[model samples]
Target: MSIKPSRGKPLDVGAIGLGPDALPAMADTAAQSRFDFRAWWPEDRRELPYELEIGSGKGTFLVQQAQQMPDTNYLGIEYAGQFARYAADRLRRHNLNNVRMLAYDAAVFVEWFCPDASFRQVHIYFPDPWPKARHHKRRLIQTPLLRQLHRVLTPNGFVRIVTDHDDYYAWIEDHVAQVTDLFERQPFERPIGAGEGEVVGTNFERKYRREGRPFNALSLRKL
Candidate 1:
């Protein structure tokens, strides 16, 4: 069952050997665009960098990445069903092949979804900062989770993170510095995607832009 949506012409990810059929796990969603198919993996092939984008709040970045990098399979995990469905629907509309979505909690499948040191790149863009000291523990890039990310990522593989909170950024720099001698931090601006003059206009990026906030992008790799 092929998915054909109303808007955004379906892309031919299958033609370039980047389509869904090759990833049998996607066969379950052949009918429903937003179906859950986590139980379909075999023993050996369960963990492939097949890619992981955590905290996929909305379809903006994940959807765009999926469409652009059809050759590199991608997965998006968002807790919000509306966003998940919208992204799935959008991906289906694009007729993209190398992308699949999951509407589950990230912590639940972090280990089971893939094997140790499998992903080459893990993205966590604009995760909640929990600015208040009282709520700081809620921030995503803490010691345990950071170490977990480090464990699951291949050596030299990167965990790309972005945020608009200055305090949070500084906190991560301090904490990660204590992790191991291999991590490097080069604080970046304007993000990797938005070109000059192109509006920094995702739902959150736009909010930051309107408030005169500068975005911080960093990549941490285990070496």
Candidate 2:
């Protein structure tokens, strides 16, 4: 179930016309409710391998991956409501049932909804750098969150991350190295045709490429 922030009460799913094809919006106010994957997803998908993407903007990467790997279930968590809604609509229009979107805090969703050894892979592309020294604490690739991610991933599961900010990439590497027992850095091989002006994983990646910026891609395997 996708959770969206609500002012007071949760929006009625029926009134919103969010059919099964569209990502359902659970009320942000309903944090007390536990998320059961077996109950949330279609009965047939309960046994499928699952993957997750954090900060999936506009659903470009999520849609492409889901279409390429129809047997794998994909879930995307986006903080922006507009992007989440747009992505959901796009998925619905394409009639893709393997992808879902949530418009809620990624950290909260991971902590509350994700189960142990649940995901086969997790992707985080172009997360906010939070360049300012004072805002460094807000960056997503911190030790605590990495620990949570480690717990949710299956044994030998992988986390793929990409960033255009050199400093942020260094920071992420440093933090990830601190948790050596749970994760190990793995070499990432960029696709043969991936370069400037080429569409990579996410929309932001393309934009950055168009701006002549280089990206650093990292992969870590859960131990």
TM-score versus the correct structure, for each prediction:
0.71, 0.82
* Model 2: worst 10 consecutive residues (lDDT sum): 12-21
Top candidate by TM-score: 2
Window of ten residues with lowest summed lDDT in model 1: 13-22
Model 2, residue 87: C-alpha shift (Å): 0.8
lDDT per residue for candidate 1 within 105-143, as digits (tens), equals 555456334446656777777778898999988777777
Report RMSD (Å) for each prediction in the order shown: 8.5, 6.8
> How many residue pairs clash per model?
2, 0
Residue-wise lDDT of candidate 2 within 77-181, one digit each (tens)? 888776777677677656778777777777877766656787998889899999999999999999989998998898999988999999999999899889999
Q: Evaluate model 2: give its lDDT.
A: 0.75
Model 1 CA deviation exceeding 4 Å by range? 1-49, 186-202
